[model samples]
Target: MSRPRLLPWSNVDGNPCYLLGDGTGSSYLSRVADNVESVQLDMAEELLNHAADLLCDSDSDSKTTSPQLRFLAARLTEALRDVHRIACSRGARLALPDGDDDDDDDDERTDD
Candidate 1:
């Protein structure tokens, strides 16, 4: 048995979810997770763009209202949480070199 994969979303109670697998990433749930993560990342990108637009507008005479800014902040927070979860899940699944369990070197490298 292999280490269980951390899922991108939590349970109804807000606890992290996991998927037990045999190491091969061909399971149905794996595909679903992949799709979901993709969607989440895309949404996050869109939200970031919207936030930039809102802030830019606020700099001009078309000032953004307090309620609109509040709503945007809330959505940005949710998007950030999803993106963080995806990063954690993917980072955990990365394969390290054999006989090298320490990830100190990884700190110097950035994923493209």
Candidate 2:
């Protein structure tokens, strides 16, 4: 089989997902990947905030630990891993395939 043009994201089972495209990161799968990545980033931010709150709690000292804190830590780790994978997949999608050099640039086109 041939290589896929678009590398969107992995499934919940951690399987690879592929899409046929022209190497431009503008396909429907790519858009979905973008949206999912945005959500994951938002989630990561929220998780960070939650972790901070846990750390700032008066009962949470260096000598003690809580079940909630442990659970949140585990969840946060998992979420971060997911976000990292998605980021890698998005990066792969942005990469130009073998001989395709057409610049579908996102840089601003200024009128001089």
Candidate 3:
């Protein structure tokens, strides 16, 4: 008999997970292993905290950010703009969801 590997899940409400993967199989373990890349995950967490702290509007009792946070916010703004350009170049278009009454009458007219 072999010992089962360990897996840490996100929630107390979530079901227990047992991940088993073959070298090339598209299994849950493979995906989780791929997603849990250490360096990239650390960078992502840094970026998330950076954006959340700097970009979010301040509430009544909040304090100002340090010099580092100011620099992070500027960098995050630039990165977001670059992402927007790439999304636009990839033909990403935002449209109202099906049967949405959100658009104006003139906006709804199309050549048919």
Best by lDDT: 1
Task: Please identify model 3 stretches exceeding 4 Å from their true place.
Answer: 1-46, 53-64, 92-112
Between candidates 1 and 2, the lDDT winner = 1
Q: Write the per-residue lDDT of candidate 2 for residues 20-49, one digit (tens) a residue.
A: 666665778767767777887888888988
Model 2, which residues run further than 4 Å from truth? 1-9, 59-65, 93-112
> How well does candidate 3 score on lDDT at residue 24?
42
lDDT computed for candidate 2:
0.69
Overall lDDT per candidate, in order of appearance = 0.88, 0.69, 0.50
Instruction: Indicate the worst ten consecutive residues by lDDT in candidate 3.
Output: 1-10
**Who is ahead in TM-score, 1 or 3?**
1
User: How big is the positional error of residue 54 in model 1, measured in Å on the Cα after superposition?
Assistant: 0.6
Query: How would you encode candidate 1's per-residue C-alpha lDDT over 1-112 as one tens digit per residue?
Result: 6678889889999999999988888999999999999999999999999888888764743677888989999999999999999988888888877877577797779888
**Model 1 compared with the native: what TM-score?**
0.83
**Top-TM-score structure, candidate number:** 1
Q: What's each prediction's TM-score?
A: 0.83, 0.61, 0.30
Steric collisions counted per model: 0, 0, 0
Residue 20 error for model 2, in Å? 3.5
